[model samples]
Target chain A: MKTKERSSENKICPLEVAVNSISGKWKVPIVWQINEGKKRPSEFLRGIAKVDRRVLNQQLKEMEQDGILTKVSFNELPPRVEYSLTELGEKLVTILWMLNDWGKLMIPAEED
Target chain B: MKTKERSSENKICPLEVAVNSISGKWKVPIVWQINEGKKRPSEFLRGIAKVDRRVLNQQLKEMEQDGILTKVSFNELPPRVEYSLTELGEKLVTILWMLNDWGKLMIPAEED
Candidate 1:
């Protein structure tokens, strides 16, 4: 895949770029599933409760394009494919955990 | 502020919650501005390029609702206000830095 085209500004905010990379509706959950060792599309389909196949595919392709995922297609009888988090993707998972923790603090404690 | 209403599901994904909190167009920029010690609305306006006052106000309100910022009003003749990152908001800054690092990896190296 080609390097992402830089924006018009000579200086780009890496934080914005990072946020944009995972902006898709299903991107976070997709990363979660893949991080959990669910590699194939079918596995991802089952792992993320409400994602449709087409949308899932689109996010997967975008993640691949962004270098967050590495896709391998096995030219076997059924044409098997697998996805894994690239180094960047793994780094994001660590950050995502931090975000999840931040989110938990916002959630109200359960009261009867 | 009232705790955020829980979604339909008995369980909520904290990662999604965290992502949604910062989903607004000017949120990250707003955070960056506040992080850099720009406390007032006018200061944020000057710090974030291309953001209008109205949109900036809306995003600031949402971030406040999400507990990412604390807003205080001083009812003086001049009407003063200030904003600061809460503890949760401070945690987000740490995570944002990590995301920034990850994003830097995706940016193409400059070539002569």
Candidate 2:
């Protein structure tokens, strides 16, 4: 897939770009699922509750286009497809872990 | 400020919470500005280009409510207000820096 084209006149903000890349509703959860060793679309549907098939497919396709995921298809009788994180995607998992920790802090302590 | 209430039935996902907290359009920019030591609202308005007063105030208010910022108001004739990142907010800055670095990788290499 071709890399997304940015207009020459607009200056790029890495933070904004990073956020935009993962802004889709199921994108983070998809990444989280893949990080946890779930590779197929069926596995993702089972893992992330409330995500419909069409939405999940769209997010997966977008992530692949964004270079965060690599999709491989097996040519057996029943076709099987698997997705894995690229090097860049692995780097993103590190950031996601940090964000998860930060999120823990946002949760208030249980009342006595 | 009182902490936001989460429903008892719903389990919290820290990553989702973190993303929701900063999903507002100018939220990240506001955080970036504050990380740079721009305390007052006027300073944020000036530092972040193209953000109007109303939108800026809303983002600042949301961040403050999310515990990412601490707001201080002075009782001067013309009220003086300042915002600074909390400990949580500081931690978020470290993550933001990492995200910024990752963003750099998304940019295509210069063609010969």
Candidate 3:
């Protein structure tokens, strides 16, 4: 039933697509969290402050669907699942690093 | 009274700060519009689709406060106003271009 990854539009705006891909506040944090080696959902909960399981899972699911993350589930007693960033996700990290640099510019030297 | 620029947190996460700086949907378009030589609000209204004046002004005000844009008012009969990107704003444009390129990768070649 689900042939297309995301909804198709006549005139797709790439910027909008980019913005929509990482729309939620939790997303960037989640991406950074993955890059920082917080793989499992439990690890994510511990790393990111105030994010509940349900919401965290939801964001993770969306990211996976968007091809930014790849999730693996192992059949264990406790059930273990880990997520890794794809090539597309890695490219996003590069952009985010640049954004972090830009964000630093907004901070005054005295403040830092 | 308002001396400080934007709110200062003790531990400023530059990534969070960067994401927060461009939270709204209209901001990227607004930046692009300005770059395309749409200087005034009236011009912005025509350039960006489905954006009302109030919302546009709100986004513009926030961008200006963030130092991404500088607003100028001309003393005339009909009143004239213009907005231009600051050096920082120009920096943002460079990043946005990268984001746009990253965005292109998400689109399938056949679809595009």
Candidate 4:
């Protein structure tokens, strides 16, 4: 058996890298909800069960800047800001679902 | 501000909690590789791009104990060890893919 050498540079497990990338308090849930089709600002605010609007807004902007989300402002009488996952962001939803599913399995259903 | 009270008990962002749960160096990648259909012990060792045999074995065993992977050993001259994702383990793949997708978006392609 020819043993292959592991690369040292990409040493950190990708999930850990993912976790550290969005380590903020609200990004994961925010990303999760956004992927769930809550595109409008108000919808995002209301969709998350426990996050405050202020923190939600803050996290959203940061995500947008981070390229995880794109903020589109439609020009109309009442200015509307629509938040959508970039192609990159959309790709994340599947993973979040897996996480949610795994969490349910790991933790007792009653505790969740 | 109708701030819904955020529970301190589940304070850690779910992703962070997820990260910590499988923080071992090889678990995430191992999980990812396993989720990708590398079920046998030899396949896991060969599939991962860089993991060492010793570390991979150690990590796989740890994950198995953590309820992430299930190992089935068949009675034979050359013991047939088959590994598969437990229900909880299966759920983590989507999240892992999301993390992989996000990594591509966040990190420059050249670096990855």
Q: Quick one: best TM-score, which candidate?
A: 3
How well docked is model 2, in DockQ terms? 0.74
Model 1 C-alpha lDDT per residue in residues A36-102, reported as the tens digit of each score: 9899999999888888999999999999999999999999998999999998889889989998998
| Per-residue lDDT of model 4, residues B72-104, tens digit only | 999999888988888777767766666765675
Q: Of the candidates shown, which would achieve the greatest DockQ relative to the real structure?
A: 1
2 or 3, greater by TM-score: 3
The B-chain TM-score of model 3 reads: 0.88
Candidate 4 lDDT by residue in tens digits, A1-112:
2343344444544556565556677787677777777788688777666778888888888888778899999999799888888877766666665665566555433364
lDDT of 2 by residue, B38-71 (tens): 9999998888889999988888888999999999
Candidate ranking under lDDT, highest first, comes to 2, 3, 1, 4
Against the true structure, candidate 1 reaches a TM-score of 0.88
Candidate 1 local lDDT, B1-112, one digit each (tens): 3345544443688888899998788898888888998999999888888899989888999999889999999999899999999988898898889989888988897675
Worst 10 residues of 1 chain B by lDDT: B1-10
Write the number of the candidate with greater TM-score, choosing between 1 and 2: 1
Candidate 1 root-mean-square deviation in Å:
4.5
Question: What CAPRI class is candidate 3?
Answer: medium
- How far off is each candidate at the interface, as Cα RMSD in Å? 0.8, 0.7, 0.7, 3.6
Docking class of 2: medium
- Runs off by more than 4 Å, candidate 1: A1-10, B1-10
How far is A81's C-alpha from truth in model 1 (Å)?
1.4
Q: For model 4, how big is the CA root-mean-square deviation?
A: 8.8
The per-residue C-alpha lDDT of model 4 at residue A69 equals: 91
Those runs of model 3 whose alpha carbons end farther than 4 Å from true positions after fitting are A1-10, B1-10
Worst 10 residues of 3 chain A by lDDT: A1-10
